[model samples]
Target: MKLRTVLGAALAAGLGWLLFAPTRVRPVAWEGPGLPPSRTSGPYADNGRLNTAELLAPVPGLKAPESVAVDAQGRLYSGFEGGAVVRFQPDGTAPEVFADTGGRPLGLRFHPDGNLLIADALRGLLRVGPEGSVQVLATGAEGVPFRFTDDLDVDRAGRFVYFTDASSRYGWPHELLDLLEHGGHGRVLRHDLHTGETVVLARGLNFPNGVTLGPDEAYLLVTETGTARVHRLWLAGERAGTLEVFADSLPGYPDNVRFDGAGTFWVALPSRRSPLLDAGARQPWLRRVIARIAERAHLPLPEESMLVALDLKGRPVAFAQGSGSASYSYITQVLPVGDALILSSLHGQTLARVPLAQVRP
Candidate 1:
């Protein structure tokens, strides 16, 4: 009788904590892109193609090479978790420190003038000169400060820098909270390189994580991680200043996207969509309870790595994926340089590469 009473009291206290505990997440109820009926069908079929990925270079203490950029000379540059940007030769050897942002760097793009632009999660947009000098370009746009400067791309003429602010309410390590909240606090902004004018191109996006300029600089694409969708914002032509869906119902949460300078756009998906997250999208109260519970416990997330290749029109042409045991998982970006596909991850200790011919016909 005493044992039963103790169990009952413990259950009651747990329920009470779940119901009334304070949480920082302010969940909003919105429609979620429901999961596909079959995970092995359509554009999401697990073909195990990413199983062939191999580590590019393994530096002793380097971790989380989130984004990589290849210079005109084919040298690769990637940012590590410790705020160090390292450069590698074309063969992924001879590692050397390029610069340190003193913050987390997520996206990288090289300007026409040989400067590297970085979207730093903790320090905002920054630029690194050839001599390894770091400069803060813009921290925010309009009246709001950037809470999570996520990704960036520079125009061919180096006149503008396009970037994404992943969240205005949550930053860095709180991304899981932002995702659970389902609040639309993300936006895409453009900064004029000449005048230093920053303007919001699109607002109210749900975790706008990746930004890339489309062909001819006519349009730009940004990934909405919470909604599993990609949006195309027109930059020129008659549809300029408009937004439309570029891709929808992605199989996983997209992290970064890069154009191959040919005809394909490579999008890195760190993990597959979570059914539990989708179910909680419209239940704000339940999400609040879950959020409060998550504070004390670590919620499980998918661990597989997936990448999608889309044509100019956003149709899926190819897919590469690996199970949880795949060589390198949690891929954040897939950049095609020369004949090899360079891959980066936010949780991986080394960059990876796969032959381009092996992934394409």
Candidate 2:
């Protein structure tokens, strides 16, 4: 009887380990090399005096504006979780239906040829013509289908489009899992219209949510949202195809990245840094268990709102933040247009544009 009891106990222990052990994720650690200290007290600090009066007035009839793209003609396009693209003219007129994407559209970028390219969570990479017709460019890579097609950027030549796949197991609804799991399920891919080829530029990325081309069009920057960092990929230099950390230790999890005309990159922080998440990142097993349970329960997690600005060389320049109290929601994307910054939220029903001059010196 003693032998049998000991064997049963051993089996139970093994089973528990199998069920609770954290999923093994590749360690993508940044030891502060080429990155500033996590905390700074200079111009980038939160002086608690950011003017958010403009953000109080929201766009009418928009829901969960994930991204905003502006064309050369000053026409603004916003993507929503309802799979609709709404066009807001420059005169603050009512928005009209630009296109019905039939899927959750996350990122919007206009090609040089007057076509709109979209990174859609359900439909994959798509192109919308001038007449509002849609076309699928690519859906899968390396024999694996995309699970969460998130953000994209178009090249100057209008022949290549670069985008991100945020996760393999979840769409936007379960992005918190990507954060807790810390597994490298995200990917950066390129689509070439001339060759009809889709290539995976970088793999094993953790929740790559936003993408943008550099000012010179020589490199691409992608946001690793789960890691609170942005990565750079050389596209034209001798180091072409090489990937490296562009910035790290962001104050919050970055959602979408865009560039301003002044050689600055603006990244939207959907949520503030959670100490619980940071601790889970240090311990793999706990994170996996939390992710599994959260997925099973289908519970909505908490997030914050923030926006950050960085220079061309990936140095933090400015930061504007809001409290996570129930009054405010998560900020998903930021676009710089003229003298205003258009902000998109994943949980709010309207888009917001805050005057740029108010947020910075």
Candidate 3:
């Protein structure tokens, strides 16, 4: 009888804590995408195309190469979780520290003037010179400051830098929490290199993760990861100053997207859609509860690597996935360099690559 009474008391305490835990997440009930198609069907049909991927340049201290930039000389540059921007020879050898952003760097792009632009999560937008000098470019737009400067792209003339602020309500540490909230707190901004002026192009987006310039700089493609959709913001032509959906119903949560300059866009999927997360999307209270618990525990995701290739018309041209025995997972960026696709990840020490020919529809 005594043991039963004690167990009941503990159970009541546990229930009370779950019901009224102090959490930063203010989940707003929103409809999430339906369950994604199985890997063997629909637009995500698995074909073992990425099975031939091979790891390259495993540095001892470098991990989570979330994004990569290749200079004209073919040297590879990437940022890690530890605020380092590392450079590697064209052959993926001789790892060297190029520059340190002193904050988390998410996206990298080289300007026509030979400066590297970085979208740092903590320090906002920055630039690194050819001789390895870091410069603060922009930390906010208009009067509002950025909370998560995620990814960026530069025009050929180096006049403007297009980038995304992943969220305004959450910092890098609370990214997952922002996604859970499903609130529209993201924005697309452009920075003028010549005038040093910053402007917000679009605002109130849901977790806009990646941005890329379309052919001829006519349009910009920004990925809204929370919605599993990509938005097309027209820059020139009759559609200029308008926003539309470029692609929707992605198979997984996209991280970074890049244009190949050969009429294709590659998108990286860190992980497939989480059914558990989707199930609670319409239940704000449940998501808040889950977020509270998630802050203290890790959410396990499937061990599958995926990438999607889309044509200029926003049609899926190819879907690639690693085989079950594949070593690469948690991929964040798929950069098409020459005849190969360089794969970056957020949890591994090595970057992987596969021949472009191996990725077929």
Candidate 4:
């Protein structure tokens, strides 16, 4: 009888914890959609032939450089673990603080006039001048304050900028929580540099990550990471205000978007293809339980290095693969420079550079 009593009590406790755990996850029921079969496998695998660009090591190792931007003169810029935007010389020498966003900076692009624009995850939209002067451009859109400003791109006209707010509910150190929750609380915001008005161009996104202006400058593209697709919004012409899925069923979670001068945009996928993540997306309770388990277990994220280039029509053009045996970790963005591509990571100690010839067929 005492054993029976103990069993009943333990059952109640277990069920209670499952139903009412003090977890950061905000559970939402979602139908885990299918990810298209990865072409990254089989004979189609990109042989990944590029040189890893080195950087000044962060103190204690792994500062997590999430994004990269280069000046015309070849200076590279990326933010470190504590929200410091560090710039390195052309030869990866003379590391110095370019501008401290004080809030974590993710996406970076230089304006036509040589000012640097940043999408700060903690702050908002920002601009860094030549001498390291900093200014806040926008923080909220349509009265919604940004919780995760992830990436940005400037149009040819330079009058407006498009950026992604990864989540409106979850902030830093909790991005995975937002991803696991699968809530469509993300958004794409356009900040008018002239009028200083920030407006939401699209909403109900699933953890949007990187963003870029199309080469034509008539439309914008934002990567919806939670859904494994890119969302396109038309800014001008008759289709203005129209939103559609530019690309879908990607091999893995897409990070930043960058336009190669040769008419393609490069996207980085840090995660290797995982059937477990796909299966968990189908069950809300299962994911919540997994999240709770992860709080203690702290499972490691897969370190597959992948970069895909898509044309304006959202067709995959080129694929570049890195190694699981290599030192790169969670590559976040692939920035296009003249004749080469630069890679950054959210959990890597150095930047990488790959020759364009190897990335293209």
Candidate 3's residue-wise lDDT over 1-361, tens digit each? 9999999999998888887989888888887877677767777887778776788777787788899999989999998888999998987888888999999999999998778899999999999999889999899987889999999999998899999999998988577788888889999999998999999999888899999999999999999988888899999998888999898878888889999888999999888887777888899888888888878887655546889999998899998887555647888899998888888988868678888888863
Off-target runs (Cα >4 Å) in candidate 1 are 324-326
Model 2 per-residue lDDT tens digits across residues 214-297 = 978889999887777889989987999999999888877788999875789999877767666676555665666665567667
Model 1 / residue 308 / CA error / Å: 0.2
Using TM-score as the measure, what is the rank order of every candidate, best first? 1, 3, 4, 2
Best by TM-score: 1
Question: Candidate 1, TM-score vs. the true structure?
Answer: 0.97
Give all candidates' CA lDDT scores: 0.88, 0.77, 0.88, 0.80
Give TM-scores for every candidate, taking all chains together and pairing residue i with residue i.
0.97, 0.85, 0.96, 0.89
Off by over 4 Å in 3: 300-303, 323-325
Compare the candidates by lDDT and give the number of the best one.
1
Q: List residue ranges in candidate 2 displaced over 4 A.
A: 1-44, 49-62, 298-302, 324-328
Candidate 1, 49-107: lDDT as tens digits: 77767777687787999999999899999999989999999999888889999999899
Model 4 Cα displacement at 299 (Å)?
Answer: 4.3
lDDT ranking from best to worst?
A: 1, 3, 4, 2
